[model samples]
Target: MSANADRDDRDLEADPASSTSGPVGVPVDAVCVGCGRTRVTRTSLEAMEIDPRVDLSDLDAADCTSFKHVCRSCWAITWRNPIAILTGLLESERGE
Candidate 1:
């Protein structure tokens, strides 16, 4: 089953990303850094290949960090309150 992107990661009892599979289910394309789910937009993945965030480039081994991308759900949240998202990222880097 596809994940409910609206759900908070903290509240998830089980990894929704793993819900699908084991016989018959949609294949997981890629995981989301923001939501930890396999739900993602083709456009966003394409965008990542085309132009990633400049600020995220210096992040150690960006391929592992994936700080440049967010899920469609988190993208919506980011657009609504980018300050919050940026602040959270900064705080995490600060070990806060």
Candidate 2:
């Protein structure tokens, strides 16, 4: 009957797909259409070292650019393009 318990119940009801005990499942900032994870981005997808033909086709480019949710788990597992990472790092270093 406490306020905290009431909130917990509400939270549970709000998102049935979320795991009760696992990685901190932050609410989807951007849902990835590929794996249905709430954590993906076009840039992140592009940075993945997948065959451009296979991977790019899987991307929901319209949604990603519109600032929607995506699959963080997929992104996490995908091999990242080192050149992209290095370029990003260099860009930051240069304050570009």
Clash pairs of candidate 2? 30-69, 30-70, 31-69, 31-70, 32-70, 32-71, 39-70, 39-72, 40-70
**CA lDDT of every candidate:** 0.34, 0.37
Task: List, residue by residue over 1-96, the lDDT tens digit for candidate 1.
Answer: 235554655457455544421112111234555566554222221223323333433422223223243457676332111111122334465583
How does candidate 2 score on lDDT? 0.37
Cα deviation at 4, candidate 1, in Å, is 50
Candidate 2 local lDDT, 1-96, one digit each (tens):
699999998998867554422223111134444565443223433233233333222433332223333335664443221211223333454484
lDDT of 1: 0.34
Instruction: Give the distance in Å from residue 38's predicted Cα in candidate 1 to where it truly belongs.
Output: 0.7
Q: Give, for candidate 1, the lowest lDDT window spanning 10 residues.
A: 78-87
Model 2 compared with the native: what TM-score? Answer: 0.18
How far residue 36's Cα lies from its native spot in candidate 1, in Å, is 0.3
